[model samples]
Target: MARDGSVLGMIEATEFLDIPTTTLADLLGREQVMDIGIRPLWGPVPRIAGPAFTVRCPPGDNLMLHAAIHRAEPGSVVVVESGDLDYALAGGNVCAVAQRRGIAGFVADGLIRDLAEVRDLRFPVYARGIIPIPGTKAAVAPLGEPVRCGGVTVAPGDIVVADEEGVVTVPAAHRTDTLTAARTKLAKEATETLDDWEAAHRSRIDEILARGGFRG
Candidate 1:
């Protein structure tokens, strides 16, 4: 946990956010990503939310991510970019290392493999999809640069909230504001909005609330 009593890892943060990122995404009017694969052995794809730290890696390369790992800060999630390359930006070994480093999780615009291990370790990871074939087999990327993931522009130190609903970036400069706004939005949701909508328009709301339900 953080010195302030805030939980530092993915699991701890979940209780504070109350709702998972996927659920939050739905609440925020985002679409469900059916394509985001899962680790069959690990059950459902885990959802995680926390402050973010973004990284840009060359397509088919993760050397920069390795470098980023060395520089990672606790309570931070490393968001990487691969232009939807469907490449293996990260997997078991890398995630294992990241866990040891005290990082929260990982978000990638590309692809990943080694399904069971990542989840078994309980380290959250978000990505466009997965592929067992791995990546293009190259390495020439730079670290701490801007990256485009899931149709969003991201930079280093940006905040990232990810879940079954998909991945969303919280720009670095707006980190504090974003967290505050999201928390307020969530607070209002739990108290009144989430249930009201479910009661008001049972039919229409049900369709929109298809996956699970959005509080706000």
Candidate 2:
């Protein structure tokens, strides 16, 4: 896992953004664990990717997130695992600070608030849902540790790619190979999209129909 001081070990956001999350998830065999339910809250661009700064907060507590926003390296995406739900863990004020500090974005397994204000600030945030009620900040949760968010276990250094579709994480161990394979698959998909359907068929239409038990 990459820590706040270990930016050199993390992949650049540009590389992750180049390949869409759908391509990565598909190449990874539709592994649902690779993706998160979190959707983009707001930004000029609906896409963001960067090394994760994993944080674990108990349900409605967001003290760790507040600390992470200030401590995490610039360009790092703050990933929080909110144990429960029903309260907003982050809001526009914190997002404004994160953006000013050069943070890439935010992803939470819980809820957040200040949707209009967050959009007005042009900051990127992804979370399970939104709520008007804010959470308690009394708890001081751990940061830079491994945690599960959106059904996937994320380490501090894992690469996160998110867009209008959703968020997908690439384990640090698989980052290089994953990106390479996803790029290859994306290229193939592009060609397949343009090639004539008839030219790419492996069998005649009659043979296909016959296999389907159709006499016509």
Top lDDT prediction, candidate number: 2
**Model 1: residue 122 alpha-carbon error in angstroms:** 1.9
What TM-score does candidate 2 reach? Answer: 0.85
Compared with the true structure, what per-residue lDDT tens digits does model 2 show for residues 1-216?
A: 435435654445558778887787786655434344566766445677888889888876788888888888887889988856788888889999999998888988888899999888878888877889988888975689998888788888788888777788887778889878888877777777434656556357767888899964
Q: Among these predicted structures, which one has the highest TM-score?
A: 2
lDDT of 1 by residue, 1-216 (tens): 133432343333444344555444544333222234321224365555555566776666666676676767666778776664556777788888888988877877667778778878877777656667555434665655676666666665555666555565545455455456667777776788756867777977777877576765
**Against the true structure, candidate 1 has what lDDT?**
0.61
Error of 2 at 200 (Å): 3.5
Q: RMSDs, each prediction?
A: 7.5, 3.0
